[model samples]
Target chain A: MPLRRWSAAAAPLAGSPGTKQIVVARENWRARAQEIAAAGGRLMALWASGPAATGRPAPRTLYAAFVLPPGLLVLTMPDDLAHDEYPGIEEVFPHASRMQRALFDVSGWRSSDPDVRPWLRHAAWPADFHPLIHETAPTAAEEPRPDDYAFVRVEGEGVHEIAVGPVHAGIIEPGHFRFSVVGEKVLKLEERLGYAHKGVERRFTELPILEGHRLAARLCGDSTVTYAWAYCQALEGLAGTPIPARAAWLRALALELERAANHLGDLGALGNDAGFAFGLSQFSLLKEQLLRATHAAFGQRYLLDFVVPGGTRADLAPEGARALSDCAGHLAQQTRVLRGIYDEHAGLRDRFAGAGMVTPALAARLGLTGLVGRASGQAHDLRSDAPWAPYDELAPGKAGATEGDVAARVAVRFDELFESCRLIGRIVRDLPGGTHLAAGLPTPPEGALGIGLIEGWRGPVMIALEAGASGSIRRCHPHDPSWQNWPVLEHAIIGNIVPDFPLINKSFNLAYSGHDL
Target chain B: MWKTLRQIARTGIVTQPPPTGDGSLRLREALQADIREILGRALCIRVVDSGSCNGCELEIQALNNPVYNLEGLGIRFVASPRHADLLLVTGPVARNMDVALRRTWDAMPDPKLVLATGDCAATGGIFGETYATRGRLASVIPVDIVVPGCPPAPERILAGILAAIRASHAHPRSR
Candidate 1:
C-alpha cells in the first residue's frame, strides 16, 4: 500500500501544529521578539543547545517562536552566537528568563539578562561539566550542592522568605521553591529544579533509533503514549516509513486513555488539595477504574511502551473496547455527582475561585500553551488542531476558558476529562483491525532533523531528533510543557495568600525531571 | 435521606472490596503472582536510573496506588544497599548518574538481584549510550532481569520483580 502524508497546514487556526517560525534581531533578541510579537507570533520556546556545527568549538544558540495555530520559526545565531550575549526576552515574555539562564548553564552560552541566576544547573555537577558539550564520565567525588535560591526581592518591611523542598511530604519528584512575601501575600517565587535531572538528553545520543522509543516514552511517563508516539513520529520522519493503520488506531486509544486518566486524577487531586475529600475519592476511583480498563486492553495501567516507531506493540481486543465503553459511562455518571459536590462546597469554591489568576495579557506575553494556557484563553490541542493519525479523522474537541485562574484551570481539566472519555470511546468503537506493528523501519537518513509535537497530559511534548552515525540519534531534545508553564506558576501565586500555593501549584503540575532535561 | 439510600444502593456503599477476589480478579491474581515472584523471600531492591526523563516514576508511583496495592505483596523499596535483596532501577544510566549507580551497586550485599525497569534501564532505550551514559543498567549493575518497555506497565513491573527473584533463586551461582 502507498503511504499517506498530512500537511502541517491542515491544522485548525488555533491548534498545535508543531513548529512556528519568526525572525528576531540578531543580537538584539528583545527587539526582534517585539517585531515578531507585533506580527502576531508567540515566543513559544528559547534554548541554546549543542555546538555551532558537528565537532565545532563554538556554541550554537537557537531562539525559537511559534504563532497561533502552529508554525515553528527559529533564529540560529552566528558561530559567535555563544560570544554574543543575546538580549533577554524576559521584559516581553517574562517566562524566557529561566530558559535563557538554563541555556547559559547547559551550553555555556551567556545571556545578557542581569538576573544571571542559574535556572536548572543547581550545581549538581562541577561548574566545568557541560554535559551537552564536553564528553567526560561522571565521578563519585561529584556532589550535588544544596541549592542556594534567591527569590525576587519585594523590599517590604514585613517581607520574609519561605523555602520549600527538593523533597516534600507527598510522593512527588524533588524540586525547590523559595517565596518572598509580606504577611500572607506572595511577592515573588523562585524555583530550583534539576534535582531529578537524570541526564536524559545526552543519553539519547547513545541509544539505537529502535530503542529510543522507550526512552522518549519515559520523558513524561503519564503520557507514555504521547511521548513514545512523538518520538516514533520523529524517527519515522527520519526513516520515511509509514505507521500501520491498526497500530495508529491503537496508539490513539492508548493516548486517549492516558489523557482521560491524568485529567480525572488531576481534577480529583485539585479538589483534594482544597479539602474536598468527596471529589478526590470519586475522581480517584474513576481514574482507578479507567486504568483498570486500560490494563485490560493494553496490559499496562499507564499504557507504557504500547506505542513504538511504525506502530503499536499490540492490538486492542473487542473485549477491551467494551471494557473502555463501560468504564467511560460509569466515570461520567460518577463525575456528575462529584461536580455537584464541588459546586455546593462553598469553602472549596472559595479557595478555587479567583485563586492564582493569570490575566490574559500576562498569559499572552509569557507564551503559555496547553491546558493551563488554554484555561487562560489559549485554545490549542495537538489532536484537534495538528490532526495526527486517529485524531485527524476523529477531530477531538478542545476546551478553553479566559478566566486564567485556578478555577478556570479546574474547569478546563473537567471539560477535557469528559471530552477525553468521548474520544476514547470513539477510538475503541472505530478501531482498525490488522497487524499492530510493521516489520521494521527504514534506515534513518543521515543529518536529517525530525520534530515531533504531541499533546501530553500536561501539555505539548516536543521532541527534536537528529540522526547520527549508524542510525543512532545525534541530538534528541524532549522539551516538556513545564518549561513554558513553570514560570507562570510563580506569577500566578503572586497577590495570592501563601497557604494556597499547593492548590495553585498542583493546578499546573509541571514535572521537575521533564524541565531538567 | 431516601435519595442518599438510593445512591448507596446504586453505587455500592463501601470504600472496601472483598479480601480475596473482585471483578478485577484476573488482574488482581496476575499482580499478586508478580508480587509473589518478585518479592519472594525478603527481596532487596536497589533503584538504578539508567537514563530516563522520569515519566516512569508516575507508573512506579501507581504501584502504590490502592488499586494495584504493591505493598500487599510484602515487597518494599529500600534506600540503601546493605539490606537490599533486589535492585529495581529506572533510566539508561545517564553519563552523570553512571558513577553513582556503580557505587550504589557495590554497596549492596552479595547474592543481591538486579532488575532493570523501563527501556532506558534495559538497553539505554531513548537515552541511548550518548556521550553521557555507559550503556544500560546491566553495564553498571549486573541485571538479572530486563523489563523491556519504555516504562513497563506497573503490573509488568510487578512481573519483572517476580522474574528477578526467580532468576536469582534458580541460579544462585550465576552472579
Candidate 2:
C-alpha cells in the first residue's frame, strides 16, 4: 500500500543484485520522498548525475536511496537544465538540506529549499561555476576571491565565537568548526567542511571503470578496505562479474581486520582524550601490532587498493592466514583487559558517560547510520539486515547500545572489536579453496547502473556506478555515512562543555575527507 | 589505577629499539648534534594536514607509540605553531587550504623547519594538480625535508623530522 502511492514503476535493480529501483515521474518526486519518509524509511544517500554522458541537451538525474528495512528503495527523477530547479525534500527529510545544497553546487540544480548558503562551494571558484557540469570550467575572468563564509551568528550578552581549524593542532584532516558559546557551554556548533575535497567524483569519470577502485580506496584512509570493497561490489555488479567464493570470503576477512584496527585506535584515543595516557600507549601498541599483521597478510599495511574490481588483487596464503589467526587471538586477549581498565577507571567513566547525548528519537529523525547510529539504538546494520555473499553466510550478530552517550559509543566499539575479531577467526578457519581472482567480466551495456551497499566499519558505505560505452566510468558517487552523521554532531555538542568536545567528537570520529569528498 | 599499574609492570619496557641504518641512524645523530649546537635540548614540532587522506596522519601518530617513543628523542608536538621549531606537514595542499597552510607557515617563529611527509605532500602522489588541489607542499611553502611514500612509515617520518632539524640548524635565520 505504501509503495503504490508514488512510484510509477518499481522493480529490482538489474545490474545491482540487492536493491530495487523505483522510477517516479518528475512531478511525483516530492510526493514519493514524502511517502518513503512517512513509511519510516531512512534516507541513505542523495546524489545527482550530470547529463554529459547522456549526449547533448539532456536533463540531469537526481537519485535518492532509502533503506526500507527489508531492502533498499531508490527513486530517480530528472531535472531539466533550462529550469535548473527541483522540488526539495528537506521538509520530508531534514538531513536532505545540506545534501541538496551539495547536489545543487555540483550539478547546477537549485533546490526549492530556502537555505541557499553554499555547502561545498567555498568561494574557491566563481559562484556561477559548477564543477560536475562538463560544459562549465573556471576561466581567467573568474579569479579566486576571499572566501567569507557567512557562518550563522549567535547574538546575546557574553555570546562569543570560537573558530577551530581547517588546519588543526592534531594531525587530523581539515575541517573548520565554528562554535557559538557563552563562556564554556556550547550553544551551537557549525561545521564548514569540504576543505579536503579533491574532486573525487569528477576524477572517477576520468579513470577506467576497472581502475576506479584505487581512487575509492583512498576516499578515506581509515575506511580504505570498506570503500574498496564497496566500489568493487558496484563495479563487478555493473559488469555482471561473479567473483570467486574464496575472494568474497577473503574480502570479509580484510574488512573485519580493518574494523578491529580502527576500533583499537579509537578506544585508545578516547582514553587519551579522557586523560588516560596509559591507555593510549597500550592501545596504540596493540593497533601497531595488528597493522603489522595485516601488512604481512595482505601485503599492504592499510589494505589500500587490495580489493579490485571482479576480485581482490592479492590472495591470503596459508601461512598468512595462520599468522592472522594468531594475531587476532592475541589482540582479543589484550583488548579484553584494556576494556576492563576503561570500565573501572572513574575519571574516564566520568568523562565518557552522559556526555554528548543523542537521543534515539533525535538519531532516527536525523537519519544517522553506522557505528554512531548503532550506539543510539538505531539497530540498522547492513551485514545483518541485507547480507551479500560472505556476510550472508557469516550472519554477523549486531551490536548496539541505547544509552546514546560517549560511554554507549565506547561500549559499541568494544563489542564490535570483539565481534570483528570473532569474524576474522571464523573467516580464516573456514577459508575457502579456489581462485581468488574473477576473470573475463563482460562490460554492461552503456548507461547501465549498479549500486553497492556494504556495512563499513563506521556505517553503510554506498557506491553508485554508471558505466560508459567504452569500459570507462560515466559517473561514480561514493557516499560516506559521515554525510548523515556530521550534522548530528552539532546536536550532540549542545550544552556540552568545550573541553568535553574532543572526547565526544572522538567517539563519533566522522571522517572529514570522507564527508568533504 | 591498580590494574593499570599492574599491567604496566607486567609489560615492562615494550619500547622497541630505534630503527638502525635505513638512513635513520645518520639522521638521528645529525639531529642530536644540531640540537646540541644550535637550539637546545628539546624540539617542539607542530603538525598540519593540508589535505591528506589521513594515512600520513596515522603514521605520524604512530611515532608517539611505545615502539617509536618519539617523546624520548626530545621531540614533541605542540598545539601552536608559534612555539614550534619544526612543522610536519602532510597532504597535497588542497586549493582551499592554500591560504591556511601559508598562514600556518608564517605563524611559526624564525629558524623554523618544514618537513613535508607522504608522497602527496612531496610530489602530489595520486591527487595531482587538479582544480581542487594546488599539488604538493613545496608549491605553497618552503619544505626542508621530503619523506615520500603513499604514506611514509613511522620510522621514515621520524628520520625526516630529524633531517629537517639538522638542516634548520645548518641554515640558521637572521632573527
What would the DockQ be for model 1?
Answer: 0.16
Off by over 4 Å in 1: A1-31, A52-63, A68-70, A80-82, A138-144, A153-155, B1-10, B13-175
In model 1, what is the error at residue A305, expressed in angstroms?
1.8
lDDT (tens digit, per residue) of candidate 2 on A1-517: 4665544356776433558887776778888888888888889888888675223333478899888867788898766445557888998888899888888777777889999988877767777777778554564222345568989999999999999998787867889999999999999999998888787777787787878888888889988888888888887877777899999999999899889988999999999999999999999999999988888887777888888877788999888888899999999998899889999999999999999999999998888889999999999898988888899899999999999999999999999999999999999999899899988777766787888877888999988888876888777888899999999999999999999999999999999877777
Query: Cα RMSDs of all predictions?
Result: 8.1, 3.8
Give the poorly placed runs of model 2, Cα more than 4 Å off.
Answer: A4-8, A14-16, A53-58, A80-82, A139-145, B20-41, B167-175
Best by DockQ: 2
- Clash list (residue pairs), candidate 2: A370-A459
Across residues A1-517, which tens digit of lDDT does each residue of candidate 1 receive? 1101212222221112354333333655556566556666665566655652233333354645444344555544444533557667777777778878877766666767898876666544666666677676455333323445565666769889888755353445556788898889898887777655666666676677778987776666666777888788778767777778888787877777888888887887898899875565556667778887887877777666778877888777779889998998787777776666676668888999999999888887777888899999877777776777767798888899999888899888888888877877777788777788988788786555676777877887777776776777767777778888988888899889988999999898787767777
Docking category of candidate 2 = medium
Candidate 1 lDDT, B1-175, residue by residue in tens? 3443444466553233212211221222333455446455446555544345565666665665555555555556665667777667776665444445566677777656677777777677645654444557766656666666655666667666655443234322122
Task: After the best TM-score superposition of candidate 1, give how far the Cα of residue A186 lies from its true spot, in angstroms.
Answer: 2.4
